[model samples]
Target chain A: MMKDEFLKKLRSHLVKIPEKEKQEILSDYVEHFQHGFHKGRTEEEMVRTLGDPRKIARELIADYHLERAQENQSFVSLFRATFTFLGLGFFNLVFMLGPLIIVLSVIFSMYVTSLILLITPLFAIEALLMESSLLEFLLRLLTSLIGAGVGLLLGMGTVRFSRTFFGWFIRYLKSNLNIIKGVNKHA
Target chain B: MNVQFKKGVLTLCVLVLTLKKDRYGYELVDHISEKFLIAEGTIYPILRRLTKDGYFTTYLSESKEGPPRKYYQLTEAGKLYAEELIGEWETFNKGVDQLIKEGLDHDEG
Candidate 1:
């Protein structure tokens, strides 16, 4: 196999990578061929030594997505990365999906709880305004103020937790990826 | 050895070799493959990962025979990482050696 054919096969397999990075990756293979030829080796010899282009492209694409997921910290990129790993057969869908669902629920519940707490004060105020007795209005106003204060505190706590969780979650996913890199094909 | 085991050892070889001097993709592939058989194409992904992690920095330098080659140098961060990995590898290697020796003796006995 010559340089062009080898690189074409690799490029086809690695369609998911960004253009710049994809080119950068291909250039490495091209340089590898040039260097091999300079060393008095044939293109076929170099190609054989390098193994299958499809497998090489798969490893690189999985890794590229993993980095994108870690850097962006967005759901789309992270999910894309996970899906790529799933294709590589390194990560099980149950393992990845289970934790993802669990974490999402925790975060979703936190936000919902904060929202409910915040609105409780408004509900109290409306009820107080309709109260015929001034004493009843006072009690409701006091209780409502307490609810609002607690709600504010809870909102701030959730924000802090989310930030910390974001940092921890990225770190967790990255460690998972690093381990995957050493995964044997048969395993 | 399993491919994962080979890859871990290859990663160590790459880091240890680069610590001595910078190396290009093909050069490192040849140097490491001389000691351990591997699919030479796989090294590139590891190189890309270490570079992305900021442990190694890459630059292109002209070769006398052809197009310029991408060379990887160990950064300050990479040096630290290499040291830690080597340390862990040493301890692990020693333990493996001990276990294998003991197992062999047991088999002989």
Candidate 2:
């Protein structure tokens, strides 16, 4: 392939990237071609040496999404990065989805449990009001209030754990990506 | 001969190359390709990544040949990173050498 053809293919594959960044990426290849020409090489020769444009674009896109996920730390970018890896191959589906499903379920259950515990006082309100004995009413209210306090603490703990888990999940994804990239094969 | 293995080392090579002097994308590719084969175009993504990571700062310089060139200079953090990688590489290299020697001797025996 000549330089123009190669760059054209690369540009098409890079539709996901923003215009400015995409242009910058293409310019790098254009500069590469110029360098090759200066070294007395043909465009076809340069293309052959550069390997496949598709693979190059894949790496660029993956890197871009990964960076975005890391920076924004939003669910949208994280899911986008995860799906991008999933698109890379079938193996990623198992690796990416397994932990994702497991962690999310665990977090969901924790939140549910905490919410139930927090609402215990509401559930006990009628029982406390109907009790004619003051001591029994006080006992019920005390137990209910304790449950609510524990619920609050558990909710706070879950939030902290989720934040830490978020950081950890990102790191895990990064290291997983490095392994797939084969950059960490020796390390 | 593994592509991934070469890629992992390519980052180290790029770091070490720019340790002494700033180098352009093509120049870096040329120097490394002379030692081992690589898809020349792949180096650009690596360059882009390292630059984005802030390990290297780049500037455009006018070349005598065609158009201006983008030259990569190692940042202070890049130097520290390169040194750390070099250390890990040396230890890893030693372990691999030992394993190879032992395997060869066992085969001969």
Candidate 3:
């Protein structure tokens, strides 16, 4: 294939990356082609040795998303990074899917528990209107207040914990992707 | 021959290549591919990543034959990184060699 066709295919396959980065990535190939041409190599030879443009784009896209995930540590970004890295090959599915489900389930359960604790005070409001004795009412309110306070603390801790956990998770995914990419002979 | 194992080594090779002097993208690819038989395109991403990771710094310089090319130079951190990887490679190499010798002796016995 011609250099232009090869690069155009690569550029089309790249998604979710900034235009500036897209240009920068393409320029590397442009420079490579120029160097090869100067060395008396044909464009076809260059393209063949470079392997598939689609495979190359997969690597770049995975790297870009992984870097973004590392930078922001947001659930959305980390999810995107993980999904993109998983796209590299099937081995990732075996390695990442089980851990991913367990991690998300653990986080989800923590959030639900915190929410349940936080709403205990609302339940105490119903208890207050049920004509309970003043002492009983006061005790119920005091316990509910304590529950809400603990909930608030737990909520904050979960947020902090999830952010740090996501950071480490992204790093693991990055190294995992690196290992898979190495095993990818076509890449 | 094991691509999975070679992947980490590829990073080491790139780091070691730039240790003595700065080299351009194509020049580095050419040198390593001559030895490793890798997909020529993959090396570019590795170069970008190593540079991003602060192991290398890049600059654009003109060439006599064509447009200017980007050159990668090792940082102090890069040198230290190369040293660490080299040390690991030596230990790993010795371990593998000893295992091979033991396996061969066992088969003969």
Candidate 4:
């Protein structure tokens, strides 16, 4: 086979593989044919020895599918982890952390900027005079306590998010190793 | 052997061997021919097939004597596929062995 003829036949055989992979496969064989030519084999002799391209193409296609399947699996796992992390972050901010931070900052501002110094004595006198007002102060204290609780929940949730992402990554690595083992056994 | 059968099995065998390490094209032909009486040309198709399938990936390394030699190595998927084929081969060989033994016994009787 002429060098061009050999490449043409090989290209036809490569139709089953994805276009990018087909190019890669062709280039390797092209290199092989060139090496053979340099070693004193004529292009015709090299092509003849390489055998039927169609049969070669079929087998190559099978291998390509297997590889693609493995890659697709990993990509799915990665996507799942990414979505999970994003969901958790959104939930934490919207439902848990955001409210807690707002409440805590409110209480801190009230504690630091209270202008009720002389009025504090009057409020203490009123505490003795009116039980209903004292009950109102207790209710406000309870709301601040709930704010602290929400802050704690957000902190714990952030830790859990990190752990889940790491766990997913580890699973991806293990599955990849198994795929490599399978390929090795066939080889 | 049927051409299709030979080609399929030869491609698998070449992929499996290349998994352990890289081998130049001619070296692969010589190694496989030592075990199976095949035309030197047959190995190239198998190599091309394996590379196309993604069972093996190839690169060129400089050679001392001539042009750069193309060396093939097994990719991860190729390794896994090789293992599966090896397992299937073992089961096939066991079944064939039993049948062969039965045939021999009948012939002797």
Candidate 5:
């Protein structure tokens, strides 16, 4: 491929960085191609030697955003990190995305379960007002209290679990960053 | 070399190579790629990271044949970092070697 076409392909694949930095990176490649040409190499040889522009961009983008996400722990940085990881390869699609969705669902369901449990006592009181027997009312109250107690415990567990999950995910993504950078063969 | 092992070693290699003399992007790429079956672009990200971390500083110099080229020079921090990393690798390498020797001695017995 020609220099312009290669640079265009690379730019298309790169996620946004600041414009000046983007220029700096592209200029480095431009220098590479320029030097190769001066050394009597063909554009095809230069491009081939450089390897896949998309894959290179993917590695840089994923590693950069993931590092930022780790340092900042901001939602925006994490969203960028996850999105860039999805662009990486089939491995990330299956391993990263699958677990991310599963963990989110688990967290969500735990929250719903806790809310339902905590509200049960209120509903039981309403049921007693509708002419239920004293024994039935007492039973409902007792069961509702037990349900709420379990719910509170589960709710607290969910909080702790979420923190642990977030930490593990950060470490997992950090290692995955190594794979993207060709530091690790597999993550 | 294993890719994981090479990644760490490559950083050290780059530092050692540039300790006294600055090297350009293609120069560094060619030097390392000659020994390892690496994609030439792999070293660029490492260079960028090291530069970002203040281990290396970059400058552009014009050549007679073409456009300017960017060169990487190790900084004071980079030199210190190289020393620390090299020291750690030596300790780790000796420990691994000793363990391997012990295992071989047992196998002979």
Candidate 6:
């Protein structure tokens, strides 16, 4: 019966406040009621001191508006932070990827150049030593293939990390949206 | 008085008063009660109905003593509505006055 009265009063209070603010006021009062009960105040005494339900509802409605205004100001700040974090993360990925691509390209080019340099010398040495030029050329080509495979692995690793970071950020945004919807439904 | 009739007129009165300025629920009750012998409980349901209808909006202001009071104010639509009601009331009063005067004159004759 008391719970019903409390909910009735609470709904009356909510009518004066905006939907978003109403939940906040309800939670605050619920907490206060719990704390007061713990302090050994009898339910009847507590309700009496709280005064008429209609009157208390009026007061809570006023406080709800004030609190809502404060929350809106903070919401603007949080919005800025969210955008800033996303921007910084995006730029950080760009910075890391740019250097990674450039380094990989440079290393691959150097490996190709070194292979060309080594092959010419190797063929010349094979010719001078009367070894088979074709055998020597084939041996140097296999070593160059191994070097290119290692470079490809390193490049793939950099791309993998970049993708992972973006995926995590998208997941975070989706979860945050879900949380907002849940709160709205509850309100 | 019939509950429906009282409710309709009281709602109209509240809308008219709130058009001038915001008034606390209790103050509204007291103001109307001074003129009509209506129960305090009656005003609350009317106020809620008016609020739901968009004729009135409510807010709370802090009181020096005790809890804050809920104040009701008329919206723009409510003001327009009140003006039309006021015009109709004036016409009805004038007609009633004329009828009463004629009746008194006939009685004298």
DockQ of each: 0.44, 0.46, 0.43, 0.16, 0.26, 0.01
Off-target runs (Cα >4 Å) in candidate 3 are A90-93, A126-134, A177-187, B1-3, B103-109
Candidate 1 Cα outliers beyond 4 Å, as residue runs? A89-97, A121-145, A176-187, B1-3
Clashing pairs in 3: none
Q: Docking quality tier of candidate 5? A: acceptable
* lDDT per residue (tens digit) for residues A40-145 in model 2: 8988888999988888888788778878877776656666667765665524445667777787778778889889889988856777667557777777778988
Instruction: Estimate, for each residue in B1-109, the C-alpha lDDT of model 4 and write its tens digit.
Output: 5443454467656766777688888778767867877756557645665565567887878878777777888889888978876675666667668889999999999
Model 5 chain B scores worst on lDDT over the 10 consecutive residues at B1-10
lDDT of 2: 0.79
- Compose the digit string of candidate 6's lDDT tens values, residues A1-187: 3644765676775564567756644543443355446546566654444445554454333333323433453323333334432332322334444554564466456556555544454444455467567777667666655655565565565456434543443344323322222223322
Error of 6 at B81 (Å): 1.3
C-alpha lDDT values of all predictions:
0.76, 0.79, 0.80, 0.58, 0.76, 0.53
List, residue by residue over A127-173, the lDDT tens digit for candidate 5: 78999898998999999999999999999998888767776777676
Provide C-alpha RMSD values for all models, in order.
4.0, 4.0, 4.2, 15.6, 6.9, 22.6
Number of backbone collisions per candidate: 0, 1, 0, 21, 0, 0
Q: Give the per-residue lDDT digits (tens) of candidate 3, residues A131-185.
A: 8888888888899999998988998988888888887787677566334332333
Instruction: Give per-residue lDDT, candidate 1, residue A59.
Output: 74
Q: Whole-model lDDT for model 3 versus the true structure?
A: 0.80
| Per-chain TM-score (chain B), model 5 | 0.83
What is the Å distance of residue A46 in model 3 from its true position?
1.0
Q: Write the per-residue lDDT of candidate 3 for residues B1-109, one digit (tens) a residue.
A: 4433555678888888888889999988899998868889988887887788788999999877676889999999889978977776676667668989999999999
Instruction: For model 1 chain A, give the 10-residue run with minimal summed lDDT.
Output: A178-187
> Which docking class does model 3 fall in?
acceptable
lDDT string for model 6 (B42-65, tens) is 455456545654678778677675
Candidate 6: where are CA atoms >4 Å away?
A1-187
* Per-residue lDDT of model 2, residues B43-80, tens digit only: 88888888888899999999676778999999999999
Locate the minimum summed-lDDT window of 10 residues in model 3 chain B. Answer: B1-10
Measured by TM-score, how close is model 4 to the native structure? 0.46
